[model samples]
Target: MSTPKPATEATIRANRAVRDALPFDDTTDIENADRGLIVRATGQILTDEGDVAWDFDRWSFLDGEAPDTVNPSLWRQSQLVSKAGIYQVADGIYQARGFDLSVQSYIRGEKGWIVVDPSISVEPTKRGYDLVCEHVEDLPVTAVIHTHSHIDHYGGVRALVTDEAVASGDVRIIAPVDFLEESVSENVMLGNAMARRKAYMYGEIVGYGPDRAVGAGLGQVTSAGTVTLIPPTDIISETGTELTVDGVRIVFQHTPGAEAPAELCFYLPDHKALCGAEIVTHTMHNLYTLRGAKIRDSLIWSKHLHEMLQLFGDAEVLFSSHHWPTWGNAELRDLIASQRDTYRYLHDETVRLANKGLTPVEIGEQVNLPDALAQKFSSRGYYGSTNHNVKSTYVYYLGWFDANPANLHPLEPTDSAPRYVEYMGGADAVLERARDDFEKGNYRWVAEVLNHVIFADPENTAARELQADTFEQLGYQAENGTWRNFYLTGAMELRDGIRKQHVLVTASADSVRAMSVSMFLDYIAMRLKAPEAVGLSAKFAVVLPDIDERYVLELGNGVLNHHPGTADDVEATLTFDRSVLDGVVLGTTDIAEAVERGDVSVEGDAHTVRSFVQLLEKFEFWFDIVTP
Candidate 1:
């Protein structure tokens, strides 16, 4: 129960100027609401103990006009997305939005319903499915379509239908090429760090308020529950791929390295609808997400948008994995065209500036969209701002090196902060100057200067308080939800210290089971304690009887390598079912206990397995971020 600081006069005036500049009177978004009508609306969906998994009413502040602390444009978008429940997108297509981070669509087919992008978790997906069932006839799901590799797009598959049903050939799971590989390995490698940053990016640690978490631009917030993944039975490998599930016809268009590493859009010929998935959402997407991943290819993203215009321009209605649907051929086309131009403009202009010998920071400060692209509600920076996107573009093409020898190898933050403080005439002098800047409404500069003081001497209470106050002002002014969350979360950590609570990384047991053997090996490699494994040289053979897979594991020079094959000369050979292996990896059961329970068999020597296990370090989820 921390109280947020009130917005200053400067911040209020800035927000008002933003309000006056935008087309607040534009009613097209409201008018577009007519395309779909909500069938049912509820506040929250609870588990057996009355724990809330999905709460649509948390964002009720958006019902009125934007507050002084929030961007008016973002408020409008939040209001639009806050409308929860099942909606009819078209004759055959229905959508369930506001239940999770992404929408779940149901297309009525000849035999049953075809579900698209079943959201992030089991509880919300099941709730959405029940709502769909209430509106339409009770129909079995014939097919499930996953548009991309992101967890929000495909994590809730098991909630819709069982794996048993999919295995029995009663239902089909469809996704783009490399979907399983991308889905399993995408977050697993950098999962701990990414999950920590994701908590800040999504405002999961912050409470909801006018000054705190309001909306995530894409949705209210990510739902917390069991995340499950069912591997796709049919992979859409190429553009113009056609599939007819039940009676509905779909034309898939692959658009990788756009919004996601593996993504596709589908055009419905019968319903005259296009499922643009995450590629074409209401807000401008991240070329580089704040939660840390490889920078996306903006050039390829723009190209895909143009391709979508060419492939599905005739469609009269459009629905995305997030946000509401857009109707009318002319309107849908305009929306797509505007989004296309936004990315193209960002990419081309960023490159142009870079070629002119400007650094990424300079380019970010210099580049501004033309009024044409800027005025479009769909192209607004409520999710991804131009400042960061410009840097992402530069890094995607040129990488982190900027051809500056001085910056090629710079001192780390901790090493440089004390030197910076000394050069600025010590922490007291730096704090005095930062306070002057803070008073002049130069909060950004204040944050920059005071950060050095805080890092140089973390026990300086005055510097910490000043830095937190500066970040509060910056958070109040941010239009992008993630930016606001990051700033505010940083401020919260500064004031109250890092939270010790555990954050869930994986969503469900199904996702754990769906992991490939290679992915498991990668996870183990990350956990290997370098100091402990320094002089250890060991070899082992792992046999998974259930999946009929064998791997030879070698450990040397503080590194572990796993390759497909059986090593009969290994020091130890372990045989177990894949499920038992999964249980050990996921910490559901101990390896020694499993061996005692006859779930795992050890041949040759059991001491090697114990020695290897002892060298692995388990990561603590709640690691410090803002502070050292």
Candidate 2:
């Protein structure tokens, strides 16, 4: 284990300044913390070999006073979120926190319990469910409500209830409209890239310490286990949708394109509690997540927060998928209002700056939360920083193009770096200048210049060391956990080179099984090597007798198209169960082997099918980032 460098004087002063500015005397958070009495606690969720997945002990540093290496405001928030266990939210409502990236809520009904957002993986979800059963009466899960399409919310469905129970109508699996499609598809297309980025975003690869991985600002960290998904039996499509599960009345408020592409907030009218989902977390949620996804609409996100306040203002308590519940009608309303203002301000101010001819970087530098929103802990940028959110806001409206023709078609990094280094008097000269900037605490500029030097000549060990040191300083000062992790991870990669580890790029077995044939085809289309498939044309018909769906696939002009119904005029016709295709896609079974085993039937030419399969490019999960 390597000991991290101590915080610099500048970083220590900055942390102290933040601590001095915040209202540390406020006891509201403490009061709210006390309300949720713990029923059970497990600090670590381990695998069969005792390998830790999600460890609360990693954040035990939060128990003490803030160290000079950590931002005090973030440390305070970490301490609050570090409280992990099953806790009573209300008379009939309970929640399991610290089990995963998201919380699992259990609403006690007349006969059974309604499970809401069952965490990220099977092991933690099962443990949480068992804890709930121990505290409350052991009852079958009557219904499972997935508030949004995010994996952390609904990926653990199989642990609490079986697909057979849902299929047989013995249990209800409820979710937002398009939940099944969005949940599976969101992470599939660019999943390998996202999974790699997620390691940095969640600090999964980084060790836990005060100077390392403290907390994700949402939860401790993501739980690693078998991620599962069960298709929803009930879809809440429209706003004002009402459902009663085991005599508990619930009203759904659809907030799609707010936090997620498919998301909803629900009000338990009988209990006077509102489940805000991920839409309204305790910390400022991301408008554009660091792990690369579609840019979220900040305007629409703000609008939905206002909508939640308007629709469920009367509710006395508010609970979200990540954090502890807020009690009292006044406090809940205030929390919603603050979060609403945070997004709205980011949106309006960013556009205001962009209209004045400012670029994304310029806007990011200029925008800051108003004093009212900034003062509140709920609106602080613990997860999503104001700098990135402002840039995301600019991108949401104008996009990557800054309208500057100079940047319209820039040279690739490799092509551009050599020239940049030459212009800056070669690699040594650039490093000398960067070292000066590093000494002056101009880490950002040092990083920018050193990047060109590294790309120009990767063997420049001095430039790499200086750049890594600069990143360490920046990481030490970052209040946002993701930002801190990204910097640290980049530095580690620069110093030690890329760590060879097998990252989980593919979706879980259950999630793959739930994917429709059309969805699977879409994934295949994405993986097609355009260069290999160029000018090559082929047509194939796929018949899944089990699902009773037939699709005609056409590959031509570097594009793969699929449509419902089969055609007689085709190169080949393949018939098989959906599971066989799933196995092939997941790389568990070879297509030729399945065909040889007679599991897959081919009525026409098989060479064309093999050719098409050969054209698909398998993604390398550990592709380098922050380097050439």
Candidate 3:
């Protein structure tokens, strides 16, 4: 196994210039982060059993000067996000920061506290609220505002409010329209694969350190705790939707198709504050998240920000779910304008270049944020890189194909690796030249060539080690935290095998039950083994009595098709509550137990459903990456 190395001379010089170019004199963010700190946490948050779930103490290392192993700009951002505490944002507004990847805000209402975008997990969010009670006022949660459908924004719903409370109207859950569908589908259908990629994205394999996971650019990292969800009671459908919850007149600006598929920002007219949610954060957010998702519309993103100015330009304070708040109307407008311009530049220039026959990769390579926009700290590539954002913009309009016939039919990495290696004078010859380039700080070229050698021969020790070293250098130089994590985690996997033995990110039990019967059936369709179904046909009626819905499942031509209501000549009619099915699928109740316990009943020959189950394949989450 190889060890992580220090920054090379070339990397050090480049990083030094970055430090010089950025505005170090500006301390507005630093002041805002510490402005309302009640008690700066210097300890750990514990679970029910007194076991540590989140340790604020360990990240105290961020107080030190930037190391050679980290981008100074990222280090600065990390330090700002590392300040964990309960802070007063205004006379009635409070924020609990650094408990998780997202901030949880509390707006003092006439009756009780209205929580906004609770953190990622139960323990942390519960702890954050408890702290608020101890330091501030102890009040019941009147409402929960899920500003978006992202997991980090609303996964902690059950921590603050329950389904019973929501049902009784004692606790009102607010979210954008399509929040439930987006939240459930995003976490369930592609859960395992996205979760695996998210491990690298969040630097889970690589622990936090000066040289390792400094920050997420927006925040430090996610809470490794129990995730929960409760459906929203009040859905904001259109822009200009106003809700006067406990005396705070909140005006909503629906920003769907911008950041999350369902996202919105709100303004407190009385407080003169605007909660930007995840749409407008301290850094440029991912246009296309590496964990896998549909490409976000940058054009729409810019439009929303422009709309924010028109609607909430007079907002005295601008608070977001991730980073610290910006005070003063002037600074708030300026920040919004800069963020707006930065994304607009990415959208416009990428399209302009694509029209001139530049491919996505070509455009990404040449495109740079103008100095006017790049100088602003918020517009910097701390989370989302300008390069990747540019590429994503091109793909957003045109799509994955670059229009070149050769590119359109390019060979898969495995299929072409051996030939590429053979053409490049074999493995040893390539490694010999790669070593020279690595010494000369040509890490990117070395990485590209070495990947072919690695794919051609996984057991080649020299090639793997060189690739690991190459990735480490790239990680050290990356300003984007996600990029750093991907590079370093890839390096770690090359040196040591994948860390798949750990807990995987999956949809919660509540999420599973909350999913519409149609969506759950869609997930079932994804699990169908196409090859097993080929030339074999099966039909079944999935009857969910709880939802008063029946869906017909059909398997033919290696594809599983499904729809609402009944179908003619179905082989089996499987009747079960959505709850019982959730328990069975989540492995809490086995199929035998469910049948014996009378949780699920079947008619019209159970053999059809049994054979259909056999045709479905269980996904193995621990598949290879950075290897064949």
Candidate 4:
């Protein structure tokens, strides 16, 4: 409940770098220019229930102490993202802002439109479609283009194209060649872990407000709306594969290495417009997304941008998935070039430092953007900062070892915590010193010291409270909304432990149903408690009635080894389509009921399959995390 001490030299230096990396002026100007544009584009001015600022305000980070928790930098970002309604980026192109991420659609030559990157939710994507229709002549949607393989970018496919339309072949869904594969890998393969990490990354447990929900800096926020994924009808395979849909010529330039593994930016020849997809956004996207992934290749990312520059150098209008569009060829060129150089600088410099045998931390300290690139507004880090990107570049090439043998076999958390406390004289001495430092406003140091104390004894409320206070003050000082949200959220978690009851709908049945049998079995493997499943050897062959396939799973020594083809000697054979499995997972239909209802049919040893299912642990969707 006490504020931490002053910022340390390192903290101050990092903040300065963060400021230099992402200047706030760009957002200010964009907000001013697009203010009226957003308001006018929305046909129904429903109560600003859809404001990004309202949904992700930072006030909730402060909780009860609303005034003190407000961070100026976060407030500014929220103001820009929350400035209300849809916006007109260009003639025939309108975007629904603040609803969820930013949905932008382009009108084709005929009395039809092509929706580019629908909002995260069905309701918002529908709203965006309606907003465009309200302004322009209402027309049939000819195509839905998914720029990349992110949930927010393509989750709203259903809103634009109904099931009937898709089934009837009236609507064409276009995307990169490996879009579906990449989407599954990123969002589903490790979905549970990613979902958990995303909760922390977006501060999902904390209520939305000025002090709490500034966002991950990509956009206003992610919508947990109906997520529907229909496989792409048209896939752009070649580099310059052009698609002429509804009289609009779209030249797709695939950028696989950068951003998502399967992402492409397209050039509109007719309009001289370039849709950068999620590659070169208004803000610096994460090379190492906090939600977790393989560290992105900054070098490859920069190279892709360089290629885009040559491909769309004369593009007069530049638009992205998140933020306002850039008008004029001059600004477009400048923005693209600057962002390209930003990544190049991080990549080249990080490698330079790494080649010199500097460790990741050491490289982080030394790596910085040149003054020219750092000063550019677009080069600034809003979504992804230079510091983290530098670390990412380092890790991507060198791995986490850092070439230090001493660090190779470092003490684990449990062993190190007590040693740290003892080395610092004692728990009381460390707490006293940290408290004194806190009074001096050295919040970073206070948090660091108290973190050791808590690790020493997690039950120590005083240490936890002090550390939480330290995090709050640091959060209050952050310029980047993500940093502020992360710090403040950390403080809240420390103070109130976890709040699992605040669970958001992570994956719907639609998403789960799309999962391949291999993915499902992988998830089951992950869910198995090693200790509980230990010493139990079980083999079962699961056959799908609807789909012509059977999977053999061997559970032995707490490891679930899968043989997709089949195992003749397997003890049990369970048969069902993907939907039946989904029904069981969603708790809509119990296994017994499913069998009785003919949704699921079991042949061979049913008891073995039942035993395996019983041994599988189901995670509580809404556990009381804040409670001790």
Best by lDDT: 3
Q: Report the Cα lDDT for residue 564, model 4.
A: 72
Give per-residue CA lDDT, model 3, range 358-472, as digits (tens).
9998999998988988888899888888999999889889989988898878888888999999999999999999999999999999999999998999999999998998898
The ten-residue window of minimal lDDT in model 1 covers: 500-509
Tens digit of lDDT per residue, candidate 2, span 512-608?
Answer: 7878888888888888889888867989899999989999999998889999996889999989998997886666876667777889888888877
RMSD of 1: 2.0
Q: What's the number of clashes in each of the models?
A: 1, 0, 0, 21
Query: What TM-score should be assigned to candidate 2?
Result: 0.96
| Root mean square deviation (Cα) for candidate 4 | 4.4
Worst 10 residues of 3 by lDDT: 584-593
What number of backbone clashes does candidate 3 have, counting pairs of residues 3 or more apart or in separate chains?
A: 0
- What C-alpha lDDT, on a 0 to 100 scale, does residue 272 get in candidate 3? 96
The candidate, 1 or 4, that scores higher on lDDT is: 1
Q: What is the per-residue lDDT of model 4 for residues 217-323, given as tens digits with 9 covering 90 to 100?
A: 66756665566778888998778999887777889998887898888889888888888888776666788987678889988888988999888898888888776
* Reference-based lDDT, residue 562, model 4: 88
> What value of lDDT does candidate 4 attain over all alpha carbons?
0.70
Once fitted onto the true fold, the runs of candidate 3 whose alpha carbons sit more than 4 angstroms away are 48-52, 501-504, 546-548, 584-600
